[model samples]
Target chain A: MDLLAGIFTDYTLRNVALGAALLGLVGGVLGSFATLRRQSLLGDVLAHAALPGICLAFLLTGTKAPLILLLGAGLAGWLASLLMLAILRSTRLPEDSTLGVILSGFFGFGIGLLTFIQHSGDSDQAGLDKFIFGQAATVVGEDVLTMAVLGGVALLLVGLLYKEFKLLTFDPAFASSLGLPVRGLGTLLTSLTVIAVMIGLQTVGVVLMAAMLIAPAAAARQWTNRLSTMVWLSAAFGVLSGVLGAVISATRENLPTGPLVVLTASLITLFSLLLAPERGLVWDWRRTRNNRRRIRLERLLLDAHVLYNHAELTPESLAQRRRAAPARAKEELEELAARGWVTGRGERWELTEQGHAEAHRLEQAMRVLPKALNPRAEGGAGGAA
Target chain B: MSSDFVIVLTAIFVSTASALLGSFLVLRRMALMADAISHAVLPGIVLAFWVSGGERATAPALLGAAAAGLLTVTLVEWLTRTGRIKNDAAIGLVFPALFSLGVLAVSLYFRNVHLDLDAVLYGEIAYAPFNTLEAFGLNLGPESLWIMGGLTLVNLLFVLLFYKELKLSTFDAGLAAALGFLPAVLHYALMSLVSLTAVGAFQSVGAILIVAFLIIPPATAYLLTQRLPVMIALAVLVGAVSSVLGYVLAILLDASIAGMMATVAGLLFGLAWLFSPVGGVLTARNRRERQRREFAARLLLAHLAHHDRPVPAREVLEEFGWSPAFLAQAQQWAQREGLLAGDPNGLRLTARGAALAGERP
Candidate 1:
C-alpha cells in the first residue's frame, strides 16, 4: 500500500514511473517488430554501439545533458544497425557471427573511448558511466518529458506505418514488388528501434535494454498469434514491468533501476512461458495429460466391450485384454467404473452406455479423428503456433 | 623488456590465443559464445576472489571461470534442448542474469575493494607492467605477461595435440560422435579453454574486450582463408599486427591500449569485409558491374544485329534508357574488340559481332 501510495503522491517516483512506463510501451512495440524479424540480437548490438556515440557526444558538447547524449547514442546505435545490415548483405559471414562481431567490436571501441576520455581529465566525474546501468533516481521532469515525446513519436510511427512495416517484416520481396520503398521503410524502422533503445539507455543501460526489447515481446508471443494483438500485449507487458520495477526499486536504496526493470520483464516472460492459457507450458502439459488419459480410458472400455462380446468376461480375460500392464489397466478400470463408463467390481469390468459411446469415439479416432481428438500430435514440438 | 614492448607483446599473445580458439568457434557457428563467456566469467572472478580469500594463485580464478563458462554452455544447451526457447533467446537470458549478478556484486560488496567495476569491464592494461611477479626473490617482469604467456603456451599445445579431434568435431560433430570421438566432451573442453583464456585476458583487456580478441582476428582470417591451418596462422598474424598497430595508435592518441587494440581490430575487419579478394564486397560488386555491362553491350549488339542497315546510335540510346556515355562506352568497347565498325552517323556490327549476337541464344 505504501509503495502504491508513493507512486501516486511522490513527484519523483511518479516521473520515474511514467518514464519507465513510456520506455516499456515504446520498447515493447518496437521490440515486437525486431523479435518477429528474428533480429532479437540487433537490440544488443545497438545498445552497445550507442556507448561510443554517447562518449563522442560528451566529448563534443562537454555537458551532461540527457537529450544531447541520447542524440549521440541514437545516431551511434543507428550506425551499428546499418553496419550489421550492410555486413549481412555483402559478406558471407553468418548472421550470428556478424552480430557477435559488430556487438563486441563496437562495444570494445566504446569502452576504449570512454577510458580515454576519462584518462584525459576532461571530466574527473564520469557522468556518462551512469548510462551503463541506469539509475532511476536521477530521472527528472525534463528527462521524463523527453522520453514521453520520443516514445510517443516511436509508437505513433509504428501505428501510422504498421502496414508497410508489417509487409516489410513478413515479406520484403513482395512488398518491394508492390512498389513500396522497402529499403527506406526498413531504415525508418531501424531508426525507431534505436530511438526506443536510446530512451531506455539512461534507465536500463545497454545490456538490459537488449532484454527489454525482446523479453516483453517474447512473453506476449505465448498469449497470442496475431501480430497486432502481440504488439498490444507486448506493450502492456512492458509498461507493467517497467513501472513495477521502478516502483519496487524505489522501496530500496541501492538497487539499480534498469536491471530490476529487466528482472521484472524477465519474470513476466517466465510467467507467460509457464502460465498463459494458450501455447504455455502448463496448458500444453495439462492438455497432453488429459488427452493421454482419455485415450487410455477409451481404449480400456473398448477392450472390455470386446471381451464381453466374445464371452470372455472373467477377470483372467480382463487381464488378457489389458496387454501392457495389468496394474495400470486395473486402475484405469476403477476410474472407468467411478465415471459410470464401466461397471462390475472384483476385477471384472463391463461397459456402461457412456462407455459404448466413448469406445466408438476412440475407434473413430483410430481412423479419421486425429486432429479433433489429439492436438499434440498435430504440432510437432512445444505447441508453437 | 620495456613496458611498452611488454604491453604490446602481452596484447599480441592474449589476442593470438583467443583468435586460435575463435576460429573453431566461428566454424561451429558459436562465435557469440565468446561474448557469452566473456560476460559470464565475471561472477566467477568475483567469487574466486571472495571464496579463495584473495589468493595470488591463478588456479582459483581459472577454476571459477571454467565452472562459469561450462555452466553457461550447459544452461544454454539445456534450454535449447528443452525446445522451449531459441538459441539466441537462451543466450539473451543467461548472460544478463549472470552479468547482472556480477554487476550487483560490484555495486554491493566490491565497491570498497580494489576490484572496481571499471577493472571488471575494462582492465588496466597500463598498470599491468607495474605489477610484477617475483619468484625466489628474482623480478619476473609483469605478472599479466607471465600469466598470459603461460596461458597462450598451454592453448598452443592444446590446439596442436588435439588438432585432429578438434577439426573433426568442429566440422562434423555427428561423424565425430559416430566414430566415438565424443564431440560433446570435446565441445566443453574447448569452451573451458575459451573461458580460461577470457579470464587470463580479463585483468588486461577486461572481460568484454576479450571477445574482440577472440572473435575479430579469427573472423578476419576467415574472410581471407578457407583451410583451418592457414586460417589459424593468419589469425595469429592478424592479431599480432592489430595489437602492434593498436599500441602505436594508442601511443599517438594517448588512449587506452586495450580499447585501441579492439578499435584497430574492428578497422581490420572492416578492411577485410570490404577488400578480401575471395568474398570481399567490392570484388563482388565489381564482378556484378562487369557482368551487367557485358550483358548490356551484348544486348546492344544483338539489337544492332537485328537491323541490316546501320542504325543511328542516338536512336538506339533513345529507345533504351541508355545514357549517351554508356552507349558511347559500349560502342567504343565493341569497336576496340573489332566487333563493330562505327562512324559519327551510325554504328554497325561487324560479322564477328553479328555472329556473337546470333550465337548468344
Candidate 2:
C-alpha cells in the first residue's frame, strides 16, 4: 500500500514507472511481430546498433535532449536493420553471424565514440554512460512524454496495419501473391520496431532491451495462438514487469531498474513455459502420463473379458495367460473391483455389466479407430486373445 | 617494453585465441554462441572475484567462466529440447538474463570494489603495461599478455590436435556420431575452450570486442575460403592485422583501443562481404547478370534460327512479347558474340548461331 502511494506521490518514482510502462507497452506490442517472424535476435542487433547513433546524436547536438537522441537512435537502428537485411539477402552468411557482425561492429564504433567524447572533457556528457546500462531513476517528465508520443504512434500503426502485418508475418509469399505491399509492410514493421527500441533505450538500455522485446511476447505465446490475444497479453505482461521492476528498483538503493525489469520478464517467461494451461511443459507431461495410464487400464479390461469368455477367470489362470505374477493379477483385480468393473473374492472373478459393456466398447473402438486406440501396436495380441 | 607495444601485443594475442576457436563455431552455425558466452561469463568473473575474497585469481576465474559457459550451452540446449522455444530465442533469452544478473550483482555487492561495470565492458587494455606478472623474483611482462598468450597457445594446440574430430563433428555430426566419435563430447570441449578464451580476453579487450575478435575474423575468412585449414589460417591473419591497425588508429584518434579493434574487424568483414571472389555480393550479382544476358542471347539466336529468311525486329517483338529495351540489349549481345548478324530493319541467325541453336533441342 505504501508502495502504491509512493507511485502516485513520489515524483521520481512516478516518472520511472511511467517511463518503464511506456517501454514495456511499446516493446511488447511490436515484439509480438518480431517474435512471430522468427526474428527475435534482430531486436538485440538493432538495440546494440543504436548505441553509436545515440552517441553521434549527443556529439552533434551538444545536448542530452531525449527527443533528438532517440531520433538519432531510431535512424541508426533503421539503417542497421536495412544493412542486415541486405547482407542476409545478398550474402551466404548465416543470419546469426550477420547479426553478430552488425551488433558488435556498430556497438564497437559506438563505444569508441563514447570514449572519445569522455576524453574530450565534455561536461554535457555527464549522463551519457547511463544510456549504456540505462538510468531509470534519471527519467523525468520530458523523457516520459517523448516515450509516450513515440510509443503511441507505434501502437496506433500496429493497430491500423494489423491484418497486413499478420499476413506478412505468417506467410509472406502468400501475402505477396494477394498483391499486398509485402516489402513495404515488412520495412514499416521493422521501422516501428526500431521506434520501440529507441523508446526502450533510456529505460532498459541496449544489452537487456532485447529481453523486453522477446520475453513478454514469448511468455504470451504459451497462452494463446491468435495474434491479437498474443499481442494484448504480451503487452500486459510487459507493463506488469516494467512497473513492478521500476518500483522495486526505486525502493532498493543498489538494484538497477533495467536488469530488474529484465529479470522480472524472464521470470514470467519461465513461469509461462512451465505452468501455462495447454502448452505448458508441466501440463504436457501430465497429459502424456494420463494417456499411458488410460491405455494400460483399457488393455487390462480387454484381457479380463477374454479370459472370462474362456471360462477361466481364476487369478492364477488369468495371471498365467497375461504373463504376470498371481499377486500382480490379484492387485489388478482389486483395482477393477474398486471401480465396480469386476466382482471377485479370493481366487475367482467375473466381469460386471459395466465392465462387459466397456470391454465391448474398447473392442469396437479398436476395430474402427485402430491407430488411435492402440498406440503400442498391441492390437494383434488383444485380437488373438 | 613500451605500453603501446604491450597493448598491441595483448590485442593480437586475444584476437588470435578467439579467431582460432571461432572458426569452428562459425562452421557449426553457432556464431552467436560466442556472443552468448561472452556476456554470460560476467557473473562468473564477478563470483570468482567475490569468492576469492576480493582478490583476482586466474584459476578460479577461468573455472568459473568455463562453468558458466557450460551452463549457458546446457540451458539453451535444454530449452530447445523442450520443444517450446527455438535455439535462437533460447540464446536471446538466457544470455541477457545472466548478463543482467551479473550487472545487478556488480552494482549491488561490488560497488566499492575495483571491479566496476565500466572495467567489465571496457577492460584496461590501455593500462596493460602496468599490470605485470612476477615469478621467482623475476619481472614478467603484462599479465594480460601472458594470459592471452597462454590462451592462444592452448586454443592453437586444441585445434591442431582435434583437427580431424572437430572437422567431422562440425560438418556432419550424424556421421561423426555414427562412427562413435562422440560429437556431443567434442562440442562441449570446444565450448569450454571458447569460454576460457572469452574470460581471458574479457579482462584485456572487454566483452563486446571479444565478440568482434571471435566472430568477425572467422566470418571474414568464411566468406573468402572453403577449405577449413585455409579458413583457420586466414582468420588468425585477419585478426592479427585488425588488432595492429586498430591499435594504430586508436592512438591517432585517441579512442578506445579495443573498440577500434572491433571497428577495424568490422571494416574487414565489410570488405570481404563486398569484394571476396568466393560468394561475394558483387561477384554473385555479376555472375547472375552475366547468366541472364547469356541466356537472353541464346533465346534471341534461337528465335532468329527458327526463320529461313531474315525476320524483321518488329516481327520478333510482336511474336515474343519482349520488352524493347531487353530485346535491344539481347540483340546487341548476340551480334557482338557473332551469333546474329542483323539490324532493326532485318535480322538473321549466323552459321555459328545456327549450330548453337541446333544444340538446344
Candidate 3:
C-alpha cells in the first residue's frame, strides 16, 4: 500500500497518465474514420514517417520545443501520406505496398538524420532519442492542455459531420451524387487521422501509435453495429487501457509506458474478437454446436417415425432398425426420452405426437434440399430426398 | 564536371536497379513489404557485426539481413494464416515488435560496442567510394555497383524466365493454383529477391532511399502508362533520373546523399501527382471543366426543348444566368456536335440530336 502511494505521488506517473488519457481520447476519435475507410494501416506508416521530421526540426531550430517538433512531425507524416497517395494513384503499386514503402523510407531517413545530428555533437539532443520509442513519463501539463484542446476539436468536428461521414463511408457514390464535397471530406478525414497520429506520437512514439489507433476501435466494433455507439465504446476502452497501462508501467522500475499500453489494448481486442456476444468465436462455436444438436434430434425423430410404420415393432427389431451403434443409439434415445420427444412402450421406442409432427415438417423441409442440391433430378424421388 | 558525371552515373545505376526490381514488387502488391523487410533487417546487420566483431565483413551483414527479411515475411504469413487476426493487424503487430526488439537489442547489448543504433538505422553511403573492388583490370567502388548489378541481373532473369507464370499468379492466385502453379513458391521467391535488393540498396542509399526507389519510380511510371511493359520501362527511367537529381541536390546542400535522393524521388512523385496526363490533379480539374461544359449544354438544350414556341438566344442566356460567351460557346458546340439544329425562330434538335437527348432523358 505504501509503495502504491509512493508511485502514485510521483510527478512522472501523473504526467504519464495525463498524456495517455489525451492520446486515448484523440486516437479513439480519429481511429473510427480510419477503420471505416479501411486505412488503419495509414496510422502505422505515418508514425514511422514522423521520425525524419522530428530529427529535421531539431536540426534546423536547435530547440527542444515539443510544439515545434510535433509540428514538424505532423508535416512529415502528412508528406508521407501524400507520397503514399501519389504512389497509389500514379503507380500500379498496391496500397499496402505504398504504405510499406513510405513508412520504411521516411523512418530510415529520420534515422540517418538523427545519426548525423548525434555525430554533430548537439548537447541538447540527450532526451530527444526517447521520442523514437516515446517517454510518457516526461509529458508536461502544458502538453496535456494542448492534447485536450486538439482532442476536443477533433471530437466536435466528427460530431458535426457524423451523418456525412457515415454516408460517405458506406456509400461513397451516393454521397457524391448528393454533392457533399467527397474530395473535401476525404482530405478532412485524412488531416484528422494525421492529427490523431501526431498527438499519440509523443506519448506512445511512432512504433505503437498505430496499435493505439487500431486496437481499441477494432475491439469496440465487435461489440456494436451502430457507428456512434462503437465510437463511444472505443473511446471508453481506449481510456481504460491507457490508464491501466500507465498504472502497470508505474508499478515496475524500468518498464516503458508505451508497450504496456499497447499490450492492454491488444488484450481488449483479443477479448472482443473471441468473446463478444454476436460475432465472437465462442458464440460462433456455440451456435454451431446447437445447430448440430438440432440436426441430430431431427434425425432421431425421423428414424423413430420410420420404425413406427414397421410391423411387429419389438425391442430387438427396434435395435436392428437403429442404424447407428447401440451405445450411441441408447444415449440419443435417453436424451429424446428426457425431452419427452420419444417414449418407451413394451421395450420399443416410439415418437410422441409432437415429435412426429416435427419429424414430418423436417422431412418436408429436407424434401426441398435434394431438389436444391441435386439439380439434375427433375422429377424423381432423388429430387425429393 | 567530374563530380556531376559520377553522381549522374551512380544515379542511373541505382535507379535502373531499383526500377527493375520494383516492377516485380508492384505487380505482387508487396511494395510495402520491401519497406518492412528493410527495417526488419536491422537486427541482421547488428548480428552480422557482432559475429564478425566489426562492420568490415559484408557477407555476415548480407546473410543476417536476408535471414531477418525472410523471418518477417514468414511471421506475417503465419499470423495471417491463423485467421484470428486481420492482415493489417498482423502487419502492425509483427513489424513494430521486431523493430522494437532490434532497438532494444542495440541499446542493451551493444551499448559498450563502438557501433551505435544510428549506424544500423542510417548507413554510411558517403564512404561507399572508400570500399574499392577489382573487377577485370579496373578498380571499382566496392559492393554498391556489384550488389546492385547482380540484383538487377537476377530481377531481369526472373521476370523474363517466368513472365507468364508471374502474370497469372499476380492477377489471379486462385486461378494460378487451379492451373498447378504454386503461388506460394513464387511469392517467397519474389520476397527473397526483394530482400536481397533492399539489403544491397541499404549500403548505398540506406533503407529510406530504397523505399523511395521502390515506390516513387513505379508510381510515376504508372501515371504515365497503363501497359505493364511501358510502365516498367518508364518506372526505371524515372528511378534513374531521380537518383541523379538527388545526388546533385545532396552535393549542393552538403547533406546525406541518400536523404537527398529520397527527397528527389518524393519531388518526382509530387510532380506526377499534380501534373500527370491521365489522372493527376490537373487532369481531374480539366475533367471537371469538361463536365461543367457538358452540363451547361444539356441545360440549354432542355430549355430550348421545353419551350412551346421559339425563344430568343438572349432570353435563353438570361434564364440560365450564364455569360453570353459561355452560352454562345455551348450553342456552337451543341450545333457542331450535332446535338442541336437551328430552325428559323430558334434552336431544335436534329434527328441524331433528338436521339441523344431522348436517350439521356
User: What's every prediction's RMSD, in angstroms?
Assistant: 7.6, 6.4, 9.5
The stretch of ten residues in a row with the least summed lDDT in candidate 1 chain A is A320-329
lDDT of 2 by residue, B222-294 (tens): 9999899999999999999999999888878888887888899999999999889998888888888878878
Q: Where does candidate 3 stray beyond 4 Å?
A: A1-7, A48-63, A75-130, A159-167, A172-184, A240-260, A267-368, A373-385, B1-18, B42-86, B113-115, B125-153, B172-175, B199-205, B274-361
lDDT of 3 by residue, B58-126 (tens): 777777878888998997787566565566766665565556555545544555531333333344432
Question: Which ten-residue region of model 3 chain B has the weakest summed lDDT?
Answer: B129-138
Q: Candidates sorted by DockQ, descending order?
A: 2, 1, 3
Q: Write the per-residue lDDT of candidate 3 for residues A1-385, one digit (tens) a residue.
A: 5434644687777777877877887787678668767787888888888988898899889898888888788899988887677656755546775675577557746764665576567788877666767778788878777777777777888889989998878888999999999978987888777788777877788767887888788788888888889889888888877887888777755556776787777788778878988878788778899999988777767776777765533445545677656666667777777888788854677778877777789889989988899877776656677
Question: Which candidate has the top score in lDDT?
Answer: 2
TM-score of predicted structure 1: 0.78
Residue pairs in clash, model 1: none
Worst 10-residue lDDT window, candidate 2 chain B: B129-138
For every candidate, the chain B TM-score is: 0.85, 0.79, 0.78
Ranked by lDDT, top first = 2, 1, 3
TM-score of each: 0.78, 0.82, 0.68
Q: Comparing 1 and 3 by TM-score, which wins? A: 1
Candidate 3 to native Cα RMSD, angstroms: 9.5
In candidate 2, stretches whose alpha carbon ends up further than 4 angstroms from where it belongs are: A288-385, B113-115, B125-141, B283-361
